[model samples]
Target: MSDYQPKILSGGEHRSDDEIMADYGVSEDSPLVIMELLQRFHVKDIMRSRNIISLTRENTLREAKELMRDNKISGLPILEGKRLFGMVSMNQIIKALEGGWLDDPCQQHMSTSLVVLEEDIPVSIALKYFHNYTFGRFPVLNKEHEFVGILSQRDITSALLKELTSEISKLEGKTEAAVVEQRPVENVKSEWVIPYYSLRQFVIVRNDLANAGKAANEIKRMLKEAGVNSKIVRKVAVAAYELEINVCIHSLGGSLTIVLDTHKVTIIAKDNGPGIKDVDWACQDGTSTANDWIRSMGFGAGMGLSNCKRVADTFNIKSVVPTGTTVICEFNLSA
Candidate 1:
């Protein structure tokens, strides 16, 4: 039987939908099934408790700004006796200042067209709200529409990451058990079969600054849990993070995969791109194609690929003019 599989690169070259399904042992109908299961996760499952910081309609813009600064938060829910009145954010503060209302009450400057979330609603619903609006946080209400807590993008990400980690761990356990049970005793004794296992996960890398390095962080966590050497894990983490950030800052968007085996860890990052015009120059230090916006965020210092190569045991890159770019980095476990 041939090991060749079809490659689909509509957006990127990481993996096709079919490839993802095969990797996870899911059928064609599995997407709907998975979404149905995901819908069972309630907002409360991921939301912070009711001890959240909030503002009041009676509070002045100055006070609200001070509260936001003190809490290191971007927004706050405005409440009156446990009832949500409005939402106040830095945008509101700036608007108030422009209108000479810095000392005025929050209600006068707050946004009243609230988009509140229910505690018992599916987290999928909250995800839609997040995709549709630019709000940093949404006020959460209970059955009586009373203020409870707030849900932010960070909260949802943390919850989903935990769920994914748990699922992957369970899958790895099952795979290891199956391998042990199926291998012949003679083969195990001789170590001819290598007794090796592999795991692959696909991660989406967006060009958003707020979400950069998230995939690499999760990969590091998984490697640590899998008993990889701390020194090797750190090196892999540095390379993975640099490559991940490179995809975010330079490419339009991309997919990254971390493949783990008994002896090696491989990271493959593929991006929809205006491919590199000069690979040699790109590999050199202080060579950058990033824009001013990315630089202002303390990124795009022209060191991503070079730094990644420095930490990786082996590295290779391929690119096409208008098609895309792919980078493969490998780290040896037994080294």
Candidate 2:
């Protein structure tokens, strides 16, 4: 929260497959392969859809609390015939008890200011939702806007770990027997390095929404032409686009510079004056200082830095009030 000091967050370090599986550590902040998996998997793929514990609006608060206790859950969606009405949390139950309103209908005490997710959303976006919102679980709806399932962090982590273990084992050429035996990843001392070299800088004009993504698109094209792995290219492209748009909207003006080499692709965004006051707060998802005009154009949803950090192998941000800010996103290519 310091205004003068830089805030840095790094993840997606090239960890061995075994370490990832042991901790079920797959996340949006994981490596290129894991990030790709998140993008490929939808919310429905990991959401709890079967035998979901729910209560109807007509149900009393006492019944809601009983269902939560019996199922060992903290929240329950208020639904009637697959149609979601509201949500009741454990806190509401406690309050009802203290107020002697435990026998009241759930609809009278349920929380209506709900944040929900679509069943078709990617796990990557779902992770962003989890980071942005404090809700322990999100109700999922289908194309017809009917309540379908509930998604939790636990569901995503467990599903991603299983997918990661299987994919990594296959990529490492581990035999079926070795994989079944849970072979140590340290035994495989190998790495694949992609040789590449490029450097480019683009001048971004302030409030230039029309041309904001040009630089990032060029970067994506060059990487594809260079034959970089699709997954790796995707991560770099996403980070690049987010950074490019950030520079265009946030600062008076700025420049985006991209460097590609044997080890990784680095995207640096440097802006003019009017630096951020709290770099730490700015990095968090759903934190924004954007004006209404910018938000109306869909330019600042506060996902810029968060998206860059989620996809980049390493992310760094620095700012000095009235001086400007610089953000660097690096995507590792090796291992």
TM-score of 1: 0.45
Q: Tell me the spans in candidate 1 whose CA falls farther than 4 Å from its real position.
A: 1-37, 182-335
- Cα displacement (angstroms), candidate 2, residue 316, comes to 48
For residue 146, model 2's alpha carbon misses the true position, in angstroms, by 0.3
TM-score, one value per model? 0.45, 0.45
Residue-level lDDT tens digits of model 2 in 149-260 = 8899999989988987776654454234323433213433222223335566677666556568987997888788767788989999998888888877787667777777
lDDT of all predictions: 0.72, 0.76
Backbone steric clashes in candidate 2, count:
0
Q: How many residue pairs clash in all the candidates, one count each?
A: 0, 0
126-225 in candidate 1: lDDT tens per residue? 6666655567777888877788888987888788778766645644664465455334344234322234644444444334445578778877887887
